[model samples]
Target: METRHLTYPDTPDAYPSVMVLGFFDGVHKGHQAVISHAKRVAAEHNLPVTVVTFDPHPKQVLSNKPDAVRYITPLSRKLKRIEALGVERCLVLTFTKELAGLSPQQFVDDYLIGAGAVHVTAGFDYSYGKFGEGTMETLPYHARDQFTTSIVTEQTRRGEKVSSTRIRKLLAEGQVDEAHELLGAPYVICGEVIHGDARGRTIGFPTANVLMDASYVMPRLGVYATRVKLQDGRTFYAMTNVGRRPTFYETGAVSVESHLFDFSEDLYGQVIEIEWIQFIRNERAFDGLDALVAQLKQDEVSARSILS
Candidate 1:
């Protein structure tokens, strides 16, 4: 898939295109429905499929206070997942103060028009430009003479709306299985394996320490059954922890560490992707190293049983 950093001045090449527009935080089932519709439209019209999304989510820029929720996916991961949907091109618009100041009409004229898109597909609740001045209700009329528009309806699973926000809420509440069902896949965090204190090595279970991308929503602190994917794309059953090293009296930043079951290798500096499958237990401050190690053994047993 081709990716572009779209700006006001840059226009798409001259071609009939169908575009999918939204923040697409988790690319959950709802977002997928929008993309799926866009793809079908593109196929019927014989136009290239393009996906347009903004960076730093509009919420981040529009927040008056500092406590707005963090993002669920970084631009890289967002684009990767969207591309996996078989879109031909992904245009990542860098949202800035200047860009946000444009009126809804100005935004459509500048970005959507610039993309040469004749058909645009988005969710029913999608809004854009200058304090959300443009909503789905207002967009089709604004584009009446310009292009075709389709507002995809909400997608629901188990009677609940499938959405990035809903998935994040589930993850934060430690309902990973429910989140996965909404996401249509397991929740995975990809990051580089950084060096830690090497304490796991001393305990005979050397682990790879992963520093996760801040943009990705982390699940509730706990030990989880996970599938670890290496840079080479090999996957393995694993047990992962998300917490401070309480047994060693360490108290600062929470870390994610994974012990790949029955695997031994030097993984320093490697990028590892962890697919969280199931939650095991909440993080706790164990009494000593032996206690922690003993609990980890139990965790591995539970993880293996669950995964197998």
Candidate 2:
């Protein structure tokens, strides 16, 4: 798939194609449904599929406070997911205040018609232009006969809408299994292995300290059943701890460390991706090394069973 990154005033070459639009954080099940429908539309119309997404997040530029806005799937990961969906081209527009100031007609004329959008697909709630006054409902009127529009209705899970916000809530609550169901896949985060206090090794459950990227939304502090993939592509079932290790230190940043079952090797400096499978238990302070070790043994058994 071809991915083009553009700023305001820079546009991709026009071609007859179907364009699907969204911020597409996580590209969860709901976003997938819209993309799936776009694929079908493209197939029927004999046109290539183009996915248009934004970067740096609109809220980051628009909101006065500009919250950190951690992403469920950052730009690199989001592009990978879009490519896997069999899209022909991707346009990642850099969201800026200048771009946000465009009027509804200006946005459609420049982004949609200019990008060769023969047809456009977006979720029903999707909005664009200054103040987000333009919505899917207003999309057709703004089409200007240059393109067509389709709106994918809200996708629901167990009667609740499947959304990036909902998925974030699930992760924050240590409900990874439910988040997985909503995402249509496992929740993944990547990190580089780093040296730690090496306390786990002395206790018999050696772990690789992982320094995760801050941009990835962190799961709630807890233990989880996870699958780890090393840089060499070796995979293993693991018990991952996301906590501050209160027993060892009363104050420190939260850390991610995983004890890989049936595997042991020098992992420092190597990178790994952790795929969260299920929430195992909450992280807590142990009385001492003995207590922590005993609990780790139980965690390993539970992780092995769940992973199996």
Candidate 3:
């Protein structure tokens, strides 16, 4: 897909394309429905589908706290998901205070019309412009018959709406299996391996300490059954711990340590994706090294069963 980093107040794109608009944080099932409809509309009209998204999230800038916002799919992962859905182009607009201050008419003129929107598709609840005053309902009024609009309604499963907020809540509760159901895939966190205290090595369970990207919404502090995919594409079953090692040190630093079953290679500086399959157990301080070791052995057995 052709990706463009667009700045505001620039010249309108000459290419007439079908535009899909949203923050599209996780690109969850609801978001997927909207994009899929855009793809279909683009196919019918013989035009490219341009997905318009924002960076740093409007919430981070608009809210009082900048760091309070976390993402289910960071910009990189969101782009990847959009590309996989057969989008033709993606416009990453840098969200700033200036952009957020635009009026509803200004938003339509710049984003939809300016970006060459022949048709627009977004979710029912999708909103834009100052304080989200511009919504799917207002798009047609602002479009002035220049383009058609489509709004995909809420997507739900098992009588519950599938949403980023719901998924985040599930992850926060260490309910990875339920999160997986809402996401329509395994919940993934990709990161680079970094150095740790190397205490797990001394205890016969060497781990890769992953330093995750800053903006990801990490799963709750606990053990999980996961599959780790290395940079080169090899996959392994893993028992991952997200906790402070209280057995070794009192109120230790929180860490993400994954022990790859049947593999013991130094992975410092390498990137890997961890796909969480199930929540094994909550993190707790063990009696000692021996007790922790025994629990780890059980964790491995549980992880192997779940990952299998």
Candidate 4:
């Protein structure tokens, strides 16, 4: 899929297109429904499917606590998911203060009409323009007959709405398995293995310290069963810990360290991906190395059982 990044007043190529609009942080099931609807519409109209998404998240620009923003999928991963959904092109609009201030009519004209969108698809609650005054009901009025619109109704699972917010909540609570069900895939973290204090090796469980993307949402601090994939295309069952080393240091920044079972390699500076499987135990300070080692042994047993 082709990617186009644009700022306000900059128009996309004037190709006849069917666009699906959303922030699509996780590209969760509800988002998939909207994109699927747009794909079907594009097929019927003989137009390419275009996915319209924003960067830096509108919340970061609009909310007072911009630094508090975290995402289920960063832009790079989100775009991959959209492309996997068969989208032909992706337009990443830079969300800025000025763009957020546009009126409903201006947004419709600048984005839809100006970009030559012949049809648009979005969730029912989707809104545009300043203060989100443009509802699905108000979209056509803003379109001025330039394009048709389709509103995908609420997508539900287990009697609740499937949403990014819900998935984030689940992840925050260390409910990775539940979040995976909603995401249609396991929650994953992509990072580079960096040098640590080499404490895991001393304890007989060598670990790869991962420096993850700060934009991604961090799961709750705990030891988890995980599947680690190396840049060299090797996969291993692993036990991952996400926490500060309270056992050694009183306080420090949180770290992600994974111990791949029955594996030995020098992984410094290697890029790797970890798929979270299940939370095993909360992070805690043990009395000494012996206690920590014992606990880790138990964790390995549990992880191996689950992975098996």
Give the per-residue Cα lDDT of candidate 1 at 39. Answer: 88
RMSD of 1: 1.7
RMSD of 4: 1.1
- How much is 46 displaced in model 2, in angstroms? 1.4
Per-model C-alpha lDDT, please?
Answer: 0.85, 0.92, 0.89, 0.92
Model 3 stretches with alpha carbons more than 4 Å out: none
Tens digits of per-residue lDDT, candidate 1, 1-308, equal 99988665555564569988898988888988999999899999888888888887766766785345566667887788898999998888877777889889888887887668798889999988888889988888767567889899878887888888788899998788888888889988888999999999898778899998776788998889999999888899998888887777667788999999989888889998999899999988888788888988899899999999
Which residue runs of candidate 2 sit more than 4 Å off their true CA positions? none
lDDT of 3 at 7: 64
Better of 1 and 2 by lDDT: 2
TM-score of decoy 1: 0.94
Compute each candidate's TM-score over C-alphas.
Answer: 0.94, 0.98, 0.97, 0.97
lDDT of 4 by residue, 1-308 (tens): 99999998787777689988899988988999999999889989899988889998998998999988999999999999999999999999999999999999998888888889999889999999999999999998888898998899999999999999999999999999999999988998899999999999988999999999888899999999999999989999999999998999999999999999999989999999999999999999999999999999999999999888
Q: Weakest 10 consecutive residues, lDDT, candidate 4?
A: 7-16
Best by TM-score: 2
Q: Give the Å error, residue 196, model 1.
A: 1.3
Task: Give the clashing residue pairs of candidate 1, or none.
Answer: none
